[model samples]
Target: MPILLLGNKDIDLISGKRNITIRRLWKQPLYRGDRLFCYWNILSKEREKIFEAEVTKVKILPFKEIISNSELPHKLGYKNSKELEKDLKKSYPNNTKDNDEFQIFEFKKLHVTQWEGSAINQKNMIIKKADILFDMGEYEQSSLCYQAALEYDPDDANLLNRIGDNLSRLGQFGDAIKNYKKAIKLQPDNEYLYNNIALVYLNKGEPDNALKMSNEAFKINPKNTTILYWRGIIYEMLNDFEEALKYFDEVLELDDTDPDVWNERGTLLNMLGKSEEALISYDKSLELCLDDTKDSNTWASKGNTLLGLQRYDEAIECYDNALKIDDSNPIILNNKGVAYMELDDFQSAIECFTKVLVMYPNNPDAQVLQEVCLENL
Candidate 1:
């Protein structure tokens, strides 16, 4: 069977938004009327058959000719010719030249019953849709899709776990726990199910219950970094700072590249009054983070550390960076106000406090700080 492996970028093809695909010529090139089995090559190395299609047309063109055509690149899923050229070079470094031949395959999707391979699995396709929705942060819609998928495979433990994840994201903690428990019943040996249960409990502010689930996961796989990180969080919530630090350190020793673990370690060190050591950990976390916006909390935490060290100007800069990503956070705004007050910049401090007060009218801290700034001025 001729297979067509699609990446995340090709998801629109499954939704019928796209019908054309450009590729470097395969050794056994697809011809008109050839049946193609399309599957999503997920990041987890799992391939889920999305659809089967019949090639309706084939056009052969040189690489340069394709890039030179404005409309052609868009039809092939690129924003423009420049993007198409860059991707072609990266995808086929050795073959992508001005004269290299490429094939444009236009295909029409076949209904499930019309497929030549094993009938398209409706459950898997729904799960794929749910996963995409989940990644897009449409938790409610993703949960509905996962629930619909359950009708096809009620006993699928992984599907149950995914539904649990969606529910957790939606803040439906009780229902999330029920789904996770159901998954655990179906796949008792899966440590991740236990880990999911722990996270739900953690979110619910039931650290004792979270610890119980974490311990169960630990018994299954003590060396797992994820389980260890959660154990540290659970311990921190229980106010066992020393024990939490141990677990965080254990996680770092095993995999030092995790920015989240480093951030957690920094928080723990700061709580323990080791401000200098905490600064180092926060810096490490920031260095490991690739996207500044995604690590806004780390930036805010670093600001707190700098404030503790009496580096008022540097602290304000860190808070400013965090505010650029999360301007609506009143706590960050108030902290920035505090930093300005520490530097004796009353006007700037008042501006920060006023912003916080605007967001949270009943914020007593902001009100008091703004009043102090006014009195100082």
Candidate 2:
């Protein structure tokens, strides 16, 4: 899917023995199960097609995790991973920041081709290109590639569905729905397409239709936790909290370790003014959230319930946890400032509100809170 360039030395070495390529900050797309055209040039931008390779495996890693590992880089002709990282830093200048991720692709070289012109080869390349772009998070470009592929063979339901997914991500809901409906006509049993249609309806502010479609998908497979989760979300958005709770309860019953469902359950319980019960749900979410940084809203929700219960110190602690994950969130800052105000710590409150104001200059609540803190001082 990705066309990559290898220097003559590296290309020769890989063709002889090596099979893995360490990747960093690669903007052009590639994925496992993708066929790649690899070009090698001894000098300058002029390239010669040396090999066609099929990606066999892909492993993604953070710099911190792989930096200490010397084994993998050594195989690729590096003295060690540190030397490799240094070289990678020059190649991927944008990845110098903390927590940057890189990938390693293991491929086997297929026969080299100087020119590719067969209709089957062209179609495969187009679909492979689309999948690579999709994996790179370039949805619009991926959609374009998929669209181009469709031009070559227009009746592909999978391509239509993929195009719909990209359009939905771009918030082109109407066009997405049209494509989805086409896919559904071809494959009606695809519950996920119905789920996508439901999501599009939700984004269009037609919650009733969203609910209907979700229910339809759920009826197709009552045990599908994802469909039930969407049904819960739609009910929650419609302010039917109790109805939302039923679906959330069913989802958790189906899978107790699901952190997202637990978090949603906590939010719903909190909305229902059942603060103590909500705390247990939040605690469950925190326990299940192996990657807590990805669950900042759960921490913030826990803080909100704590604040409502007037547990100012505990609320501040929870808010601090949330801030650690997303320090610049104005809503969390505002809420933390309110917790400080509740404890009559006006100066601390002022600082938090000031931060919120800096992030959201026109925020009325933060502005009023700042004024109130100043007056108290």
Candidate 3:
């Protein structure tokens, strides 16, 4: 029987009761609380359907020992403890995957053997309080709870990282950086710490420093794809297109299906005036687009490409698609008016310019375009 703790590290596993004796299992490996994600294909007797449950709990008792109890069945979702651990590790990437999908989650290991029942009880109470604060978005208060937990064990790197993360969320970037630095010093090999620190630098607009930190992390573990992706973005911002292209190429080689990367590559190609190549990139981006974010950007990119090619009518249609996605966008509105003027649709041009003027009353270009459209009318 293997039971994953849903939340909070303070509760006992074998028995739901607080202040129970935890043996050696709890002693050797420090347990950080985990939000349970069980992979199961179980049939519900009443529903007669194979259903899945992503059981979330504010706190969990040790359920791994459920098999030992006569009332529980011997069957388990995972084959063994090692397999379960491996799955847990795979759930969060060590960097290869990009975007928010690969974000690191807070997890702790609790050993059933070494826990002092009395201490566990008190810890459970503390964790419950912290959970409430965290739910309320009181990250500072939640961090304080984790900090207080550290008084008993100063060497807990996981808790330290969580505290830093919370601080970062609260916009205390400098303080978060300090905590992350400390965590990196303590656990020099932790990729998450390095990445977190790099993020702080990026948020602070120190892209050079962020790139440097990300490079160090990449060097430590070349397989961290997230760092590679971010490094490419840094190079892009710095206008080092060749280097940025290299990194983007690497990401594409790994996951070519990411429309955002294709869109970005197209932008770089456009910057270099490789209109034909940029069009191809934009096409790829559109092919992989599954949502408005990807689709909208594709429309905008196509509009720019057409405008560059002097295809005014085509450009107007592209801009219309983009405006459909984000109607109030000033840039798209202005661009649409420019396309209308180029196509000699003076009436439509005036309407487009008037819309822009309504949204941005001080827009000098809109006023000028409006004047031109009215003069031509």
Would you list the C-alpha lDDT of every candidate in the order shown? 0.88, 0.82, 0.65
lDDT (Cα) of model 3: 0.65
Per-residue lDDT of candidate 2, residues 266-327 (tens digit): 99998999999999999999988987565788999999999999999999999999999999
Between candidates 1 and 2, name the one with more favorable TM-score.
2
Model 2 TM-score relative to the real fold: 0.67
Query: What stretches of model 3 exceed 4 Å from their correct place?
Result: 1-154
lDDT of 3 by residue, 1-377 (tens): 12323223322211122222221122223233422321111112211111112222222223333222342221223455455334434543352221221111222323424332212343444445555657778787677766755655677787678778888889899898888888888899977788788888878888888888887788787666677677778888778988888887888888888888888889888888888898888889888998996688788888988888889898898888888888887778878888888889989988888888888998988899889889988
Determine the backbone clash count of candidate 2: 0
Clashing pairs in 2: none
How does each model score on TM-score?
0.65, 0.67, 0.61
From the highest TM-score down, the ranking of the candidates is 2, 1, 3
Error of 3 at 121 (Å): 8.2
Where model 2 places Cα greater than 4 Å from the true spot, the runs are 1-121, 151-153, 291-293
Name the weakest run of 10 consecutive residues (lDDT summed) in model 3: 46-55
